[model samples]
Target chain A: MLGFVSGIDRDLLRQFERVSQQMERMMGLRGANGIRSGGVNAFPAVNLGASPEQVDVYVFVAGMDAEKLDISLQQNLLSISGERKAALPEDAQVYRNERFNGAFRRVVTLPEDIDPDQVNASYRDGVLHITVKRKEEAKPRQIQVN
Target chain B: MSENKHIEAQDQENSAMQARGEPESVMLPPVDIYEDANGFTLLADLPGVTRERLNIQVDGNDLTIEGEAAIDMPENMDALYADVASTRYQRRFTLSSELATDDIRAEMKDGVLTLRMPKRAELQPRKIEVSAG
Candidate 1:
């Protein structure tokens, strides 16, 4: 039943993908143990925004220390990686374990080239805020309208 | 590098607002609860929430955890892409009488809240020594 597609292939494929993803999220089965190998809607949802001066990326990751976080930028792709160690006491009996702990990665492709030196990252109240200034040449230049 | 990126571009043209009569959505933050010989340890993920904004209360065997995240967006900036949704965190747990609710210790750091609630003296495991015959 998964071999051939004859009519309305694109629509069917889109529907199927949406349904499957929703099911995975509902079942808490998404993400590769907190490692995102370049897939959309991966672990640790993020917000990306770009201003005239810089590009900003905010990732929601709690229970991680500075030593556990590793960030690097190569070309236009910015990578974020970190690990959240499990917080369980010794000889403890677990009642509920809904939160996920371990390694996680998130990558975003910027629209314009950013100066690697101008990148700034800060961790506050459990959120990691990253800002990369836009390159001077990449910013829009407006000529006097004649 | 052909990995899938989940970032979605935020639409800037359409400025829609929630209805005034509608109630704000409350998100149930994920948590882990573990019980040990002395007490229980609870860890909850509450990103973007400050210590002042987070509140934990226990009353009549009911434990409630709530936090509000204040994400201040700069006026000069515009959202180009977004995947994470902003939400207020809330969760409630019914505690057993065997647990001591008065001396619960709570701490928030790195966006995680850890709560240590000790069990009553009678609830904790204890070994009794037998007299030699």
Candidate 2:
């Protein structure tokens, strides 16, 4: 390994290291849709919003078939997995390639106060919307005046 | 020299406007342009854009596609883990003279927009027959 490392030019090795670091920073800093991913940068960009009674989760996954998408909930973690097919024809010559197409998995940790049984999800125009109702006990309660 | 200086000043003013957030941020949506026997096909990834808010226009040889995504946020909701943000989708494509720009067809489904630009009748291939004289 040391001999192999020395075989490459020092300047080339330095450039490679710099590029790798830059790639790591890019993947770590931004989420799928260029938003600030809190901790993990998964394939599908996700947004988690909550209301007083429920939590709403939105996943940005374009060109995905509805029947092929899979969503699972385990404890406080929600996993979304699916594949996006290439849109161009096989014989066509590609000019610009930027869209990503492959099997992807995104695991998001939801709030613990959510009710697992009451979770509902829907897909529209390529965005997956998931709504999980919060537990009654977790919601704010009004106190009675004696 | 005066005209060049005037152009430089205009460029500086435009950049200043961008820095001040006066101009909307434009994102380059990933796109794939393919050419085949027919003409050309363009596929763009535009997530969260609904049909009602999507628009496609063709002027001369320039084609423009724009869509607005209105992300539904619950009242008093906070983002615990956020990655994707709602934004407008805009892109432009320049067509060659060989293509029939007026007959271009566009369709949006599952957040992916597909545009088919057919070739002109004269540009299509035609087989010729030869006879011995």
lDDT of 1 by residue, A68-134 (tens): 7898998778889887787566578999987877788878777557888799888888788888998
RMSD per candidate (Å) reads: 12.5, 6.5
DockQ of each: 0.52, 0.63
The best candidate by lDDT is 2
Off by over 4 Å in 1: A1-20, A23-41, A141-146, B1-23, B130-133
Tell me the tens digit of each residue's lDDT in model 1 across B1-133: 2232322222221222243443456778889999888998899989988899999989899999999986766567776555555568999999988898887999999889999999987888897999999
TM-score, predicted candidate 2 vs. hidden true structure: 0.77
Pairs with steric clashes in candidate 1: A38-B4
On the 0 to 100 scale, the lDDT of residue A11 in model 1 is: 78
Worst 10 residues of 2 chain A by lDDT: A32-41
